[model samples]
Target: MKPSTGRQKALAKALTALIPLAPFSDAEAIREAAGQRKLRELPPSIAVWIATVAHVRHEHSDYDALLDEGYDRDSARHFVIDQMNAVLTTWRATRLVEGDEDEGE
Candidate 1:
């Protein structure tokens, strides 16, 4: 519906860089521990974000829900981080497919 903004592009580049850091190893740790479970290779779609629905929709974070339901704490965090990364990935993907429609020569 809209073109990807500069911010979105920059963020995509950043997340794309972090793709190599998936499943963080002991040598490269995140917030809690070094040897925790690795994250998904692709970003998690935590919520059902419709590209053509009322501009935006409210979707709850699956990660938080998991945390509340006594799920694996580390895994929940990993998914949350993945989802954040997904925002950028999503932007890039959407743009590569449809982002140019809004642009003018």
Candidate 2:
């Protein structure tokens, strides 16, 4: 489904500032996924967050392999949290802090 042009444009604008550290291809993929979520009526920020995390989980972490190995979803995600956060740091989506709590899935 086609999201409204206004929302698309706005999302693109937000993403430009949000993920300046991301490579062009990664940014493009995130934008496309976020746009899909936006079409489902999620708020742009929420859509972007979901898309970004999913991308990091699938592309930059061992999440899928862990799942394939019979780990439950939460357990797999727990194991991959640090890897996911590292990717988010590279993308400028988050920063590491000493003593910071886990960012829940």
Of the candidates shown, which would achieve the greatest lDDT relative to the real structure?
2
Clashing pairs in 1: 23-38
TM-score of 1: 0.25
Quote the lDDT for 61 in model 2: 90
Leading candidate by TM-score: 2
How good is model 2 by TM-score?
0.79
Query: What's the CA RMSD for each of the models?
Result: 16.1, 4.1
The digit string of per-residue lDDT tens for model 2 on 1-105 reads: 233698787777667666668887888888888878334487676666667777878898999999999999878877888897787687786433222333323
The clash numbers for all candidates, in the given order, read 1, 0
lDDT per model vs. reference: 0.31, 0.72
The candidate 1 region of ten consecutive residues with least summed lDDT is 46-55
lDDT of 2 at 101: 38
